[model samples]
Target chain A: MGGSEHDDGRNGKTPSAVVGDVDDFWAQALVDVPRETYVLRLYVVGNSPRSRGAIRNVRKLCDEHLAGRFDLEVHDLNQEPWLARDAQIVAAPTLVRERPLPVQRIIGSLSDIERVLVGLGVSPNPAVDP
Target chain B: MDTYESKTPVGETITKSTNVLQKVPTGIKGFDEITVGGLPRGRTTLVCGSAGAGKTLFALEFLVRGATEHGEPGVFIAFEETAVELTQSVASLGFDLDGLVASKKLAIDYVHVERSEILETGDYDLNGLFVRLEYAIASVGAKRVVIDSLETLFSALGNEGILRSEFRRLFRWLKDRGVTAIITGERGDGTLTRHGIEEYVSDCVILLEQRVHERFATRYLRVVKYRGTMHGTNEYPFLIHAGGISVVPVTSLGLTHIASDERMSTGVPRLDAMLGGKGIFRGSSVLISGTPGTGKSSLAAHAVQSACRRGERCLYFAFEESQGQFVRNMRSIGVDLKPWLDQGRLQFHASRPTLFGLEMHLANIHRLVEAFDPSVVVIDPVTNFEMVATNAEVRAMLMRLVDFLKSRGITAVFTSLTAGSGALEETDVGISSLMDTWLLVQFLEGSGERNRGLYVLKSRGMSHSNQVREFHLGSHGIDLLDVYVGPAGVLTGSARQTQEAKERADAIARQQEMDRKQRDLARKRAQIEAQILALRAEFEAEEQEVMAILEQDKRRELVLGRDREQMARLRQADPNKQQNGGGAG
Candidate 1:
C-alpha cells in the first residue's frame, strides 16, 4: 500500500489536542508493525459517500498489502436495518478485524493502512535497508 | 502485588489427595511468561497507560486470550467505545469479539460515560460495573476481567480523591469475589496513573507510551511497578498489530551465569577448535561486539540455531522485531525458526530495547528463563541497554544476570553494538567486560567488502582462538574460518589484515572450544552428582514408605500382644476358667 494514508499527514488529522507526547492508541499505531492476519467487517448505512469511500479506501489497502491474507466482510446497515440495532453499529463505515486474535474495530476509514494493519496484528515494518 | 504472605495455608491434612484448586492462566502471552506461571488466581493487575497505548487492546487480550488460549472467559468494560465499535475495532485486531460473545467466552460491556447527565448524591456503588462484569464473567465461567480506561469515571465524576478511594474499594471487592482483574487507567505525565489510580493500584502497573523519534514512531510498554515481585523497568517496544499489541522487552538478562564444561559449537568448527578444541563452554556468557551491519546479530542467531538443533532450549531476544518478523527475516539467511518454535525448543523474546528500564529487562529475562527453562539464551545487542541504564547500573545488572544464569546453569550469548577502532574492550558500553569470551565483529577498512570477522579477547579458565576470522552469512548459515589475525593491530579495525585476523580467530575459537569442553565435563559431573542425589531421595522415599509400613505393623503386633496377654490373665482369673478352657479345648 502507498504510504499516503498511513503517513501522519500535515493536515487537520494532526491531533487537535496539543500533546507533546502522544497518549492515544492511534498514535502508538503510527509506528506500524508487521502483519499477522485479520478479518474485518465494515458497518455502513448504504451506498452513501462516506461509506462508499471508506469501503473503497480499505479495499485498496487489503488488495495492496493484505491481499489474500485477510477476509473483509462489509455489512450495509441500510440493507439489513435490524443489524444497526442488534449489533449496535452506531457509527457507519466501522471496520472490524474479527479473526486471528485480539479482535479490533476501527470507527473510521480503515483508510490508514498503518493503523488498520497495526490493529490487525501486522506490526509496523522496519525499513529493510536499516 | 499478590501479597500472598498473610494468606498462607494454615491447617490441612498433608496426606490428602486433591487437585481441585486449579487456577486459570492470564490471557496475555508474554505477560504470563514474565509472571513466571501466571497471575495469582484471584487478584487484580491495574494496567494504566497513556491514552491509546493499547489499554483497551490489553484488556481485550487479557479477556480474549484468556478465554480462547487458556480457556478462561473474560469481561471487557469499555467506557468510550460502544460495544459494536469495540467489537469492530477488535475485529481488525483479528479478535472475533462478536464470535466470542456468541460462544459466551467473552463479553463486552460499553459503559457510556455521559458527562452531561446524572447526580450521585447517595452511596452509589459502581454496582452497575460490578453487575455487568459479574454477569459477563459468570455467563461463560470467566476467570479474568478487564475495565478499559477506568479513568473515564474519574473524568466524569469530577472528584479525584473520591475516585481514588472508590477504586481501592472496587478492586478489593473484585478480589474478594475471586476475579483476576485488569483495570486500565489513562496516563498523565509525571503521574503513575490518571485520576491517581496508582494510589489504589500500586500492585502492578504497566505503562505504555508512544514515542516518535526521527519521524519514526514506537510504542513502549514498561512495567513501572509491581509491588511484591520484580519486573522489568525498561520501556518494552510494542506494536499495535492485528493481534492487538505485541510487546517486545529485550533480554532482561541478569548476571546469572552457570559455569559449564559442556562443549557447545558456534556452528563454526575452527572457532570451536580455537576455544581449546571442545567448544564455547556450556552456560558460558559470550559477548560479540561489533559496529552496525557487522553481522553481529546474524552470527548470534546462527549460534543459537546451532544450539537449538542440538536439543537445547534457546531463547533469542530480539530488540528489534516481533518473533514472526524475526523468523521471516532470518529465513532469508537460511535460519529456520519455525521448527524450533514449533517444538517449543527455541523461544523468541523480541522487543525494542528502549521499551523497558534496564532492571525491567533483567526481570523479563529472568521471568522468560524461568517460564521457558531454556538452556541457551541470546540477546541481540546489549549496547542498546546503555540508553536505559547508567554505566554502573548496567555493569551491576549484567553481573547479576550473569550470576543468575550461572545459578540456573544457562549459557548466555549477547551481541553488543560498537563504533570503535578495535574490539569492544575499549568501549565501556559494550558487554565485553562481563563476558568470558569476547568475539569481535567489524568492517575491514581497506577491502571495503563488508567483511565479517571474529576473535576471542579473553576466556576465563580456558584457552580460545586469538585470530580474527573472515566469515559470511550464506544459505546454510554463518561459516567461520580457521585463519589468523593480520599484522595490523586488531584494534586498528582495518580489513588489510583480514587473512591474518581470520587465522587468529580460528585459533582462539579452538582454544575456547577445548576450554569449554573441560568446563562442560565438570558441569556434567555436577549434573551427575545432582542426579545421584535425586535418585537417593527417590530411594529414601521408598525406604520411608517401607519403614512407615513396618513401623505400623510393629505397633499393630504390640497391640495384639497386649490384648492376648490381657485375655490370658482374664481367663486365669475367672472362677470357671478351667471348666471353660477344658470345654473349649
Candidate 2:
C-alpha cells in the first residue's frame, strides 16, 4: 500500500494493483491484502532456459519468504524493450523491485536464494524452513 | 547504407566496411574551404573544446546546415540541453528548428540521464540508447547525427569500461548505418577529449580553443588529425555570429591564381606616372608603409575611391578609425567616399585590432571580401594589429589574406604605420616580400617645414620610376610633386623652392652676361671699320697729287725737247716704235 496506481482508462490497472479485489478466484487466493506487499518485476527474453530458470528461482524464493504477500509481473524484454529505458536496463533477466518505495534492481539468474532475499529486503520463513 | 558512391576503390574498404567513406560538406562559412571538401562521411568526428569554445554551436550548426542546405535530414541528440532550450539558443541565428521539425527534416531527442534515476545492472551495453537512436533516425530518415558533448555520458554513467565500449559501439553503429555523425566532447587535461574519446574515434579530430588576452576573447580551431585527407595544420581563428561558426584558414594551395594583365589607377596622376603609367596591377597586393601623417591612409583612400568610380565594389577595413570617422577624414583630404558608400559601390568595415585576434580579423576581412564581392580591398594601418598579435602572427595572417585575394583576382592594399625615425628599410613585420607592389611614404623635413615624400619601393613585373615624389594633399585632392635632387640630395617644401629660385637666377644672369659681351664686340668691329675707311681716303689723295706733279715735269721736258724735236722727230718715230716694243717686252 505504498503508492496506488491511478488509471484514467488509458491503461488497465496493472496486476500488482489488483491485490485482493478481483472476481477471479486465483486473484482472491490471497484472501486479505497485506499491509505491505512486495512489488517485483522480472525482465526476461522469451522462453529461454536461463529466463525460465531465473523466473522459477525468483518465484520460489519469493513464495517461501513472503507467500500471499507479494505481487510479481514478468516481462519479456524482446517484446517490450522500450521499457528498459525507464530503469536504464541493459542486461536480460533483470529483477526490479518497483514498489514499497526506493526501487532496487539486480541482474542475474536469481539462483542464489539468500542473496536474492537479502537484495529484495525479505527474510525467509523460519517455520517453513524447519 | 550506400552513403558513398560506387566509384570508391576496392582497397579503401578497410577504413569503412559497409560504405566507402566520402566527405560531407558542413556548409559552415570558410570551414569547407579549409577542409578542402568536408568532414569524413559516415564516420564520427570528435570535436573537443573547452568551455564556451563553441562546441555545442558547432554541432548544432552542422545539423542545421545539413538539414537546410544539403537536403539531408539530421538528428540532434542533446545530452545537456532540451529541445526547447536548443531551439531557443539558436533562434538568433535564423535557424527555424521548429519549422524543420514540423517538416520532418530535423529531429531533436533530449536524453535526460540522471544518476539517481539510472540504476546500473550488470553487463549493460547501452542498447537502450541504440534503440532510441535507431527509432529517431528511422522516423526522420536522417542521414546526419549529432551527439553534443559525449563527456556527459561518461559523467552520467560513472563507469569508464562501459563508456569506452559504448563509445566504440556507437561509432561503429553509425558507420555501419552509413550516417555521418558529429560527437562533441569537452577538452581534457593533456588529451584531446575529456574522457579520452579520441582513442575511439580515429577518422577525424578537431580541437577548438578560446583565449582571453588583453580583455579580448578569440576562438581558434585546429584539426588535430584527419586520417585520409590533407587539412590545414595551422591554428585558425574562428568567429561565432548570427549565421554560425566560421573558421579562417591561414593558408591556401600552391600559387595557381591567374595573374591579370589588366591595370588599375592609383587615383593620383603623378603617382600613376611613377608606376610606369600603368599604376598597380589589377589583382596585385600593394603595401604602403610610412610614418604617421605621411598620407598612407590618403593613398589607400584614393585607390578605393578610384575603384569605386570605376563601378567596381571596394571594401575598406579600417583598424584605427570608425567608419564615420574614416569617411569624414577622407572628406577633409578631398576624397569623397560618401558617394560611393551611398551608391553601394564601396563598403567600410572598421574595428579595433583589439576587438579580436589577428586571425579573427583576417577571417572577418575574408568574410567581408567574399560577401561584398569587391574588386579592391584596403586595410588602413595594418600595424595596429601589432597590439593584438605578434609580428610573426601578423605576417602569417597577411600572407593568407594576400594569397586568398590574389587567387580571386582581387586587388589588396595594406597600409602599415612605421613608428620612430629609424624606419629606413624596415617594412614592419617584414611582410614586404608578399606585396606585388610597395609604396613607401616618408617624411621630408627641411627649412622648418614637414612634407610627405612617396617613392616606389618595388613594382613586380613592371617598370616603375625610381624618383621620389613629394606627396601633396591639396583642396582638389592628392597631387604628387617631383622631388628636387640638388646638392642637398633630395629637397622638398621651402628648401626645394629656395634651391629652384637660386638655379633660375643663375641661369638668367648667365644669359645677360653673354648678351653684354656680344654688344661690346659689335662696337669694336664698327670702330675698326671707320679707321680703315679713313686710311683708304688719305692714301688716294696722296697718289693723285703725285700724278699731277709728274705730268707738269713731262710738259717742261717737252718744250725743251721742241728744239731738238725736229731733228729727233724722224728718229723719234723709229725710237718711239723701238721704245714701245722694248716697253712691251
Q: Which candidate is the best by lDDT?
A: 2
Model 1 residue runs over 4 Å out of place are A1-130, B1-24, B33-37, B117-131, B157-169, B201-204, B210-260, B264-273, B282-424, B440-455, B465-585
Candidate 2: regions farther than 4 A off = A1-130, B1-21, B427-429, B526-585
* Candidate 1 lDDT, A1-130, residue by residue in tens: 1212322222222334346655664554453322334556666654656666777867776666665556666776545544444443423455555554344545554556675655555543344211
Q: Residues B1-585, candidate 1, lDDT per residue (tens digit)?
A: 211112323223112314332234555545554544445556677777777677788778778888778777787777788889988878888889889899898877776644433222212224334444555566678678888778877756554565565576677666666677888887777886756777766457777777654334556777776655555666566666544555543454343334566778886676777788877888788888877877777777778788888888988888866888878878888888799899988888878877756655776786789888988888877777767655665676677677677668888888888766554558844456667877777665544445666666777767776677666667877776533333544332244445557768999999999999999999999999999999999999999999999999999999997886667667775547644553242
Candidate with best TM-score: 2
lDDT of 2 by residue, B190-246 (tens): 988778889888899989999876566778898898887888887888888766787
Candidate 2, DockQ score (0 to 1): 0.14
TM-scores of all models? 0.46, 0.80
How well does candidate 2 score on lDDT at residue A124? 69
